[model samples]
Target: MPEKVNGIVADAIRRVRTSSGVPLAFAGVVTGPTTLRLQHFVGQHVGALSGLSVDVGHGLGGKVVALNRLLAVDDYLRTPQITHRYNTLIEREGLRAVMAAPVIVDRSPVAVIYGAMHTPTPIGGRMLDALASEARAVEQEIVAARARMEHAAEGENEMRDRMTAAFARLRDLAGTVDDARIAEELEAITRVLIAGEEPAEEPTVELTGREQDVLSLAALGYPNARIAETLGITVHTVKGYMKDAMRKLGASSRLEAVVTARRSGLLP
Candidate 1:
């Protein structure tokens, strides 16, 4: 069971106790797949609540635990359909009309709550709806917390991988580069990659390494014919590369593409 669900359960008990004037308010949490453990019990005597793990389909709580639904009984001592184990607590607390509601999450029952009174009265449908609403709110909080944790985990993993790859590159180039200037340049690249900066370029106009090469020349005031001649491609092919580059760079004109490339460090 999620921790947030417990808060909702405790709050629900308070709500029921306030509205119904019932002294006996208890919360039962499922310890395992088949065992419903009494988590919180409030009354004159809570001693009977100890070691109370009802197995599925065995005791009064077991029936409630097994059914995964709310239950009520006006006559606990004489309910032939239910077992007699919890009768002691019921009798001790002067509880007669015992109410139980199952806490459900992801279509599975994870916990159960019980409220009892010395006498019998029909537990209202609105109270039941309140119980269900509280349960759903807790489930939503649990799911949202899980999603945030998973997203953080993914970001941590990505940063770790990028740092590992950067170190490997530096290690490979260590012997060839003896100057401090080259080493400082490599460290700066490492910091930028670790920070998750997207090259200061618009993601809508993301560019390929080769496409960048083509655009830099275009930005340098070269015509398609001249660019194709210099780069060993036809004028039509040059136009195609420029089109793709412009789309990625978010540039409506040749001047904008060059500026975008320079800012992104692709041209520089």
Candidate 2:
């Protein structure tokens, strides 16, 4: 289990215990391929379960983990639905009844949270529902955390691909240019681009309504003449708008201006 998940489960245990009025609430995380170790707990007077390892299908928790469902035994020591391997520990702690809820993530059981009573009181439906609700909350937290991590990883991969393409384009331009000074300048820009340094501060640039309309058409591969005809403007006026837009965007070419505008949310 992830360290973040461990903290989440721990907080879930505390929440469940407080909300349900359960005397003892504890949790075991799947620390191995087939075993869950008792990790976090509350209201424990005995240390018999301090380092207990519950294997799949071996105990009540194991059964819950293996079945991927909630399990409760009113008389835990005598329950036939599960094996009694941990009865000694339960007896040591003087627990008469217990319930286990599995925290599943991505269709796999990642942790098991348990609630118990020191007396021979059966866990009621309402209390069981509360425990299951906490487990569901933990499952949602895990799923959301995983989604954020995956989204960040995808963003990083996209940025790397873009940087690689930019570097390749700069290299190609450097090789094709005849002017030595221009080639050296392109080489220097390539080094800066590859270094991935943060720009000082971005200018807060906005495009006018007319400028946006022209750029949107230009992005669709419209020539200046076609844009002028579509917008009921002269070709010279279209060129003037594009030139001003490109200057504000700090783009040397029409394509770069369009890309910058879209990236900066200046154009759709």
The candidate that wins on TM-score is 2
Query: Relative to the true structure, how large is the alpha-carbon lDDT of every model?
Result: 0.66, 0.82
Candidate 2 per-residue lDDT over residues 1-268, each given as its tens digit: 2898899999999998887788889999998778999888887657778779999998899999899999998888887898999999989988888899999987899999989888777789988999999999999998888889899999975775565455545655676799999999987876565345443334379776567667767776789998788777899999999999999889999999877865665543
Sliding window of 10 residues with minimal summed lDDT for model 1: 166-175
Off by over 4 Å in 2: 45-47, 193-268
RMSD to the native, candidate 1? Answer: 14.0
Q: Give each model a TM-score.
A: 0.56, 0.65
Distance from true location, Cα of 160 in model 1, Å: 3.7
